[model samples]
Target: MTSPGVAPGLLRVQGLCSGYGRSQVLFGVDLHIGEGEILGVLGRNGMGKTTLVRSIMGLLRPTGGTVELGGRAIVGLAPHRVARQGIAVVPEGRQVFANLSVLEHLTAFARGGHGTAHAWTIDRLLHLFPRLAERRSNLGGQLSGGEQQMLAIARALATNPRLLILDEATEGLAPLVREEVWHALSTLRQAGMSMLVIDKYVRRLIGLADRHVILEKGEVAWTGSSAQLEADRSLWSRHLGL
Candidate 1:
């Protein structure tokens, strides 16, 4: 399902280790995402899920290890530089600019030079998120939680990233809204958008992602297909305490 102009295995991470102050979070984390593949990173809370995403996005520098995007080393680059390298993140809590309008947020990061031609654009993002279009003039702080989540994703996509990394892809949202978020992800997968999705919804993730990586504490505890995950439910109960 690779797009005509898109390449596969666009992002790769090896031996990633990071933490806050003296508390180590991730240790020797290794993972990769192929073009058009939806890879799910599953684990319980405080299992270094957010830390892993932060390390890859350059929000936190890894104590040791390497991060590569499209075969280039990006381990210690700045966050802005990482973004320029075609990586975008929809962080947990949907942290949008509180005073900025919907249009302002989208246009702020619409730098299109690095992305592929015919990449995600303002019109396309608006089309994908109709609710955002309806509230283009509303301040980001005024939108509902679900709307903020949608805007967060739309804002990232507007950057035309090669890999979209979502941390806690769906958390604390109403059931119906969570379904909408998942449905949006399905649509993106069909459109050949590669993603590194972090979520607690293991049941639904098995159906959405092509591959799964379970993190125990901070290391890769298991890696396999969705079928393998289901066939071994004990695996989740053991490592994830689900």
Candidate 2:
């Protein structure tokens, strides 16, 4: 599903390579996410999953390769510039500001969501995440782990991005809270929100992602659809350590 007058996919990272200082992490990584499609990035810890996300989000500049959003080159842009291209992220570790209230966090970077008929406004976000609404007056440090994850997501949604990236989406959340987060993600997918999800729950990802990209030591180790992944359990056994 291409955006009007744009290409079919929301994101494309071709031969991506980057790292801190000279310690190269990502090595020629390649992947894509179509509009309204969900792509799961899976790998063991330190395999460059977050590095890829950081590269795409302009948190790190790639030493080689290209990053395209809606078919336009976005490599070497500033984080704000990349964000202006209608991208948002729920970074790993939540990164919630202890001083900010739930409402403050949500409104920090309010940009009416793109490519959606129903943009993610504060009211809409509150409705979507009732717990956040309940804790609207609470400080970020006051909320539980589940509440923080929801807040992080809500903060991103408030920007109304065309592509939403969630690093370690369900990490550290309670089982029930993870289910809640996943359920919300499923709803967003159905609502046509293109997403790149990184999570440890392989089984849940198999059901949620339209496609999967397995990163092994910062490289594209495997790429396939849910059906292909499910048909080959060896993928998990070998690459994911499942």
* Best candidate (score: TM-score): 2
Residue pairs that clash (backbone atoms under 3 angstroms), model 2: 113-160
For each candidate, what is the lDDT? 0.87, 0.89
Candidate 1 lDDT, tens digit per residue, 52-120? 988888889899999999899998899999998898999998999999999999999886735465678
TM-score of each: 0.93, 0.95
- Residue ranges of candidate 1 with Cα displaced over 4 Å: 1-8, 113-117
- C-alpha displacement of 125 in model 1, angstroms? 0.9
TM-score of 2: 0.95
Q: Would you give me the overall lDDT of model 2?
A: 0.89
